[model samples]
Target: MALAGCGTINTVMREDGVAARELKSQKTYCQSIPRVYSGVSYNFCRLNGEPNPDGAFDGHLNFVPFVFVDSLISGILDTALLPYTIYRQSADGSIIIR
Candidate 1:
């Protein structure tokens, strides 16, 4: 529970640098995905439709599911890149759009 709280804090309270930019951009990507067939992406728009602590972290949380689905369509094995993805997210935040 405590660890989960840290995710948001980590996202909002992190240093503004390259990593921060990447995280923000990921969220931007999620928002940009068309609503036609991307649940995670659509949820991204909903989850991040407003500015809030959770919204900032939603990028990280949604990344896996996004990649999970994106991978299927694009034929990219994103799960295999979990370490980078997870680290990017944890350092940035995680997905919770369910």
Candidate 2:
């Protein structure tokens, strides 16, 4: 005796060339923005628990960590400047600039 299966299997095939062509065209037409990792710097300043007179500036910047040798070199060259300024954050998670 042979046993019978409980469910039936169905298969569908697509033969429309116009729908396939349209789908391909639409897929190619959709574009996306390319992701990039550009180095940028954000500067903020605060003084004596108060906002600084100048506003924060944001621009392209190269970030480098300070080490003993670099610090010595910077001191010799007198090119080191105060790096960052502190600012207050608002309730809405935005930086408050004075």
Candidate 3:
């Protein structure tokens, strides 16, 4: 569960490939994502744009439930990290995915 959140994945273990490309495809005007609630924001970015056919997989379908659970966990983690994140947000101005 610690590693299941998209925010964790994006911020800690992201790699350049289908997911990165798909995120890029979202075309969100957001050049950066705030550290506060970044997990939720990552989920939003993932869900915001048109679905990426190539990024979808049967195995991933099975993981949907975990992803939802992880989002909740991520939210809690985000809140816990608020003070530090707020400072990071001001210093860094958010994580740049674009």
TM-score, per-candidate, Cα-based:
0.24, 0.15, 0.62
In angstroms, the error of model 2 at 70 is 0.2
Per-residue lDDT of model 3, residues 30-96, tens digit only: 4556677877676666555555466543333223455576678768877877887788678766677
lDDT of each: 0.36, 0.19, 0.59
> What is the Å distance of residue 5 in model 2 from its true position?
72
TM-score of 1: 0.24
For model 2, residues 1-98, the per-residue Cα lDDT tens digits are: 00010000000011223222322332322121111100011111101122222434212111122222333433333222212111111212222122
Off by over 4 Å in 2: 1-66, 79-98
- Give each prediction's root-mean-square deviation over alpha carbons: 13.8, 29.0, 4.7
Q: Which ten residues in a row have the lowest lDDT in candidate 2?
A: 2-11
RMSD in angstroms between candidate 2 and the native structure over all alpha carbons? 29.0
Instruction: Highest lDDT: give the candidate number.
Output: 3
Clashing pairs in 1: 60-94, 61-94, 61-95, 62-95, 89-93
Off by over 4 Å in 1: 1-75, 94-98
